[model samples]
Target: MRKKRGIVKRRETGIKYEISRKNLHYEKALDEIIRIFETENYRDRTINDYRRNWREFFKIIGKENVFDVTREDFRKYIRQRMQMDGLAAGTVNIRLGGVKSIFSRLVKEGILTENPGKDIPKLRTDEKPIFAFSDRQLKRLFSIIDKTSVAGYRDYVAMITMLYCGLRANEIENLEISDIDFDNSVIMLPGSKNKNRKIRAVPMNRKVREELRQLIIENQENFGEDVTHVFLTTFGEPIHHGLIRKRMHKYGKDAGLIDEARVSPHSLRHTFAIRYLKNGGDIRTLQMILGHSDITTTQVYLRYNNDDIIEQYNKATENDDLNL
Candidate 1:
C-alpha cells in the first residue's frame, strides 16, 4: 500500500512538470514570433509596427500561453478595439494583420497546431481616392516657401525631385550625390520600395536638372567634399522625413492649401502621376518611372473624370461615319 501511494505521487508530479514545460514552450514561441521579423530583415518601421501591435495584444490576453487563445478571443479583442478605442476599420485591420502574422509564424515553426487569427474576418474599409495637388495649389504652395533662404532652397529641390521624378519620401531622403548622372540628365535610384528591387533611372527635364545642379553646388559650398547626401537640414545633417513633413505642412498652411486637404510629400508624387497621364504619358512608361512592379499599381494614380471620359469617347468616334 505504501509503495502504491509513492508511485501515484510520482505520476502526479511528472504530469505537473510536463504541463509547466508546455506552458513555457508556448511563451517562448511567442517571443520567437517577434524575433522572426528582425531576423528576416523587415524594414525598421514595419518591425516597430509589429512590436506595437503585439504589445497591445499581449496586454489584453497576457504574455504567457498564446497556444490557448481562441478565434473568438480575437473577435472580442477586435470589437473592444473598435468600440472602446475608436479605432477605424483600417487601423483595426492593420493590427489584426500583425496578430495573424504572429500566429502564422508560430504554426510554421510547429509551436502551434493551428493559427487562430487566420479565420477571423478583417474589417472592411473604403478605399479613398489618391489626392494630388492641382496646378493652382502647386503654384500657391511654392510661392509660400522663402526661396532665398538655404532651408527653402533645399526644400524646393526636394519638392521638385518628388514632383518630377515620382520618388518616395524615404527615397528622396536617402539620395546621394553619386546617384545623380549630370552628363545624362538622369537620376539613378539604386533602391526602391518595389519587390523586384531593380535599379531605375529617372530622366530629368531642363527645370529639374537646373534645380539639382544648384543644389549640388550649394551643398558642396556648405558641407565640403565628404558629405555624400544631396539634401541636408539647416544644421548640415542629412534630411529626415519628419522635418520634410513639418516644413511641407507649414508651407501648405501658409499658402491656404491645408484647409481642404492635407498636403504631404506623397501628394507631389501623385501630382506627378496625374500630370504625366494628362500630358499623354502611357501607363507602361509611367509604371517604369514610378518604380512599380505592376502596371495595376500605377493605374491607381490615374484619376479620370466624366469630362475626360467624354473627350476620349468623342475622339474615338470622330473617325466613325455615323452622322448622328
Candidate 2:
C-alpha cells in the first residue's frame, strides 16, 4: 500500500492515528539510480562506488527523506569526510562525484524539483610535482632485478613496458598477446582497457619491442600457446595488479631508491613522459602516446628544472657576450 506524495502514512491505535516515521523514497530512488548507471555503461567498480557513497550519505543524513536533504547537509557530510574521515580533497571529490550524479539524476527524473547538489562547489586541490625517476636512479633500480629467472624476466619486461611505453597499471594488467603489433612496433590498447575508453595505439621504442617480443615468445613456450595475456605469474596464470605493484615496490626498496623517489607503475609512466620531453619529443605527440584526453596533462612535463633553465638561458644568449 502506497501513500500519496505529501501524505504521511498513519497507523490506527484505537481512535488515534500516528504518523509513520520512516523515509518512504530512499530505497526506490537508489534502485532507480543504479539502473540508470547501468544503462549509461558505467563500469562495475564505478557503480559500486556510487552505491557505497549513496549508502554512506543516507546513513550520515540520519533518517531524513532524500527529498528533504539540503545543501547544508551535503556540506556537513563533506566536512565529516574531510575532518573525521581524514580524506584528501581529491579523494573526497571522487566520492562526492557519485552523490552529485545521483542528485542530478533525481532532479532530471522529476523525483526532485530542485537539486541541492547543483550549487555544491568543488574543493580546492593542491598541485603536486610529478615524481619521475632519474636515469641514474633507473639504472640503479634495474640493476637489482634478477632477470635470469623466468618470473624475474617477466617482471623486468613489465617494468620496461611501463617505462618505455607509458602504459597505465590497469592497461598493463589487462594486456594480451593480441594487443602487441610486432611488425608495426606498437601496442594496441582496446577501448575496454584504456582509461578514456577509446582505442589507442602506443608506439614502442626498440627496447620495449625487443623485451616484449622475447617475453611473448617465452610465455608461449612455457605457459602453452593458448595463454592470451602477455604477462604471467610463474604458475602460468595471468599477472595481477597487486603482484606487479608488490614486485615493483620490492625492487624500489632493494635498489634503495625509496628514500628519494617512488618506484611504482605510475612513476614509471611519469619517468617515460619526462624522458620523452627531454629527448625533444613534442608535447602533443606525448599526449597521444600517453593516451591523455587533455593536452594540459602533457604540459606538466614542460615545467623544467633549474639546471635545464640555466642551460637553455645560456644557449639563447650565446652570441650576446659581455667580454670586451
Candidate 3:
C-alpha cells in the first residue's frame, strides 16, 4: 500500500483539487491558439489583432508557463494595462477578450485544468457618441477634393460610395467591376465584416451610380482591362487600407472638421446611417444596409436628440396649434 496524497482546498472558492501541476508553455499555447484561429477561417487581420493583444498580455505576465497565470494575476494585469498604459476601458476589454480566448483553447485541449481568465470581469466602457459629417461638412469635404487629378477622382468616388452605400474601406478597396450590377442598380459585397460572411447587396443611389460610371470610364482609359479592383493606386494596383484612412483624414482636416472626433473613413458610414434614419429609414432596413448581423449594432448609430423629436412633433402638429 502507498501513502495517499493530501487534497488542496482553494481558500477563495472552497474547491478541492489534487496536488498536481501541469507544465504548459505559454509560447506553445499561444501558437496552438493561433492555429485554432486559422482552422476556424479567421481573417488575417483578425488573427493579427489577436496576436497583438496576446503578445502584450504575455509581456505583462512575464511567465513562460501557461498554468502559472492565476486569476489574481489576470486582474492585476488588467489594472496595470489601464493605469500604467492609459488604455481606455473598451481597449482593455478587447485585450482581455484575447487572453480569454487563449486560455479557453488551452483548457479545451487538456493542457490546463481550468482557465484563469474565465472569471475575469470586463471593464465597463462608456459608449462614445457616434461622429458623423453634417450636410454642410459633407459639402465642404467634397468641395475640397480636386476631381480633375486621377488620385483625386479615385478618392472622390471612393468617398461617395462609402457615404451613400455605407461600404467599409476594405469592401470598397476589394470591389471588382463584376460586383457592380449596373443593370439592377446595386453593388454586391461578397465578403463583409459580419460573422456569417454572407454576400450583401446594397442599392446604388444616383450619386453612387454616377461616380461608379465615372470610375469605370477612368479605369478603362488608364488600365485598359489590366486591373480588377475598383479602387486603384496611381500604379494601377489595388489601394491599401492605410492609404484610404490617411486620405479620409486629410480630406476631413481640409474640410475643417474636428480632429478629436476621429473623422475618418468610418465616419462616412456613421454619417450615412444617421442621415438614413433622419430621412425616415427604419432601423431594420438600416441593419440590412450596414451588413450588421445584429440590429443592436445598427441601433448604436441612431443618435436622435430631443430637438429632433421636437422638430418632428412640431412638423406633425403644425396646423393643429389650437391657441391653447
Candidate 4:
C-alpha cells in the first residue's frame, strides 16, 4: 500500500512519510540556509541578511528551484529594489549582495548548477564629495555655544569630540562612562562600524576636556557616578542624533552660518577632515584619525581645499586692477 502511494514506510515501525517534490527542493536549500542563521554558527548578521534576501527571492520566484532562476529573474529583482524610492543606494547594494551570496552558496552546495548573478555588475553607491567646515568656522561656532548651560556644555563637548575624533553617530551613542581616559587624553571607540576592536585614541583638546569634566561632575551630583551616557537629553536619557541635529540647526541660525546644503550630525566629521587638511595634515594621517579603512575616502577632503584656493585667487587677482 505504501509503495503504491509513493510513501516511504519503515518495515519495523510501520511509519509512513510522503515527501513532495517542492518540499524536497526547499529542504535541500532553503531549510539549510535557515538553519545556518538560527544556529548562530555564523556570528555575524550576514547570515540573517542573506536569509532575508532568500525569503524575498523565494517569494518572487514562487516555488521555483534554485537551478530554475534565470538571469532575467535576477534583473527583475534588481529593478524591484531600485523602485524602492526611500531605500538608499548603499542599502540596495547590501540587499543585492546578500542575494548574490545566497546563490553562490547554493552553487557551492551543488543545489544550484550556476549562479545567475555571477556576471552581474555590482551597484555603485559612491557618495558625493564630503563637505566639512573650516577651522575658523569651527572655532567661531564653538565660541557662540555657552558651556555654562547644562545642555549647552554637553552639545559643545559632543560636537568637539565628533569633529576632532571623527566618531560616527552610532559609535558616540554607545559610549560608556568607563570609555573616557582623561589621563591618556583619549576615549575608546567600542564596536565601531568598521568592526575594529582597537581603541581609537583621540586627543582631548583642553577646552573640550574642561567642559567634559564639569559635565561629568554635574551628572554625578544629580544622577550619581554609575550613569553611562556621556550626553543626555533633558529627561536624562542618552542624546539622540535627531536632537543633536536640531541643536546644530539652531546654533547655525544663531551664528549666522549660511549654506545652501543641509547640515546634519555627519557634517561635523567632514568639517573635521577639511579643518585637519587645511591645517597641513597629511591624507594618510587624516585617514587613520577618521577610522577610514580606505585612503580613497580621505582624499575627498581635497575638495574643500578648492574653496580656500579660490578665495586666495580672488584676493590675489582683485588688487591687480584689471578692470580696464
Per-candidate total of colliding backbone pairs: 0, 0, 0, 2
Better of 3 and 4 by TM-score: 3
Off by over 4 Å in 4: 1-67, 83-91, 109-111, 124-127, 134-149, 191-198, 240-243, 246-259, 311-324
Per-residue C-alpha lDDT of model 3 across residues 1-324, encoded as one tens digit per residue: 987667655443233445465455566567777877798889888889888877778789787766678888888788899899899999889878978987787677655678888887788889887777777778888898999999999999999899999888778878888889998899877765344598888998987897898898888789887667888998888888678889878887887776544667888988888888888888998898889988888888665443477888899999895885
Q: How do the residues 169-248 of candidate 2 rate in per-residue lDDT, one tens digit apiece?
A: 88888899899999999898988888888999999989899998899899899989899998898888998767888999
Q: Which residue runs does candidate 2 get wrong by more than 4 Å?
A: 1-25, 304-307, 313-324
lDDT of each: 0.78, 0.83, 0.80, 0.69
lDDT string, candidate 1, 119-219, tens digits: 88888898767878877889889998887999999999999889998888878888888999989999888754333568988888989889988988888
Q: In terms of TM-score, which candidate is stronger, 1 or 3? A: 3
Using TM-score as the measure, which candidate wins?
Answer: 2
lDDT of 4 by residue, 1-324 (tens): 464446554343232334343223433465565564466455355566776777786676565566567788777777776775456667767777877877786666554567888887877776766656655666667788888877887888788778877766666666666777887777766543333545565566676667677777887776777778888866677877577778877887777775643355688888777877887888987887777778887787887677789999999988796675
Q: Considering lDDT, which of the candidate structures 1 and 2 is the better prediction for this target?
A: 2
RMSD of each: 5.7, 5.6, 5.9, 5.7
TM-score list, all predictions:
0.83, 0.88, 0.86, 0.74
Candidate 2 has a TM-score of: 0.88
For model 4, give the 10-residue run with minimal summed lDDT.
Answer: 14-23
lDDT of 2 at 50: 88
* Shift of residue 210 alpha carbon in model 3, Å: 2.1
* Clashing residue pairs in candidate 4 (N, C-alpha, C atoms within 3 angstroms): 132-271, 133-271
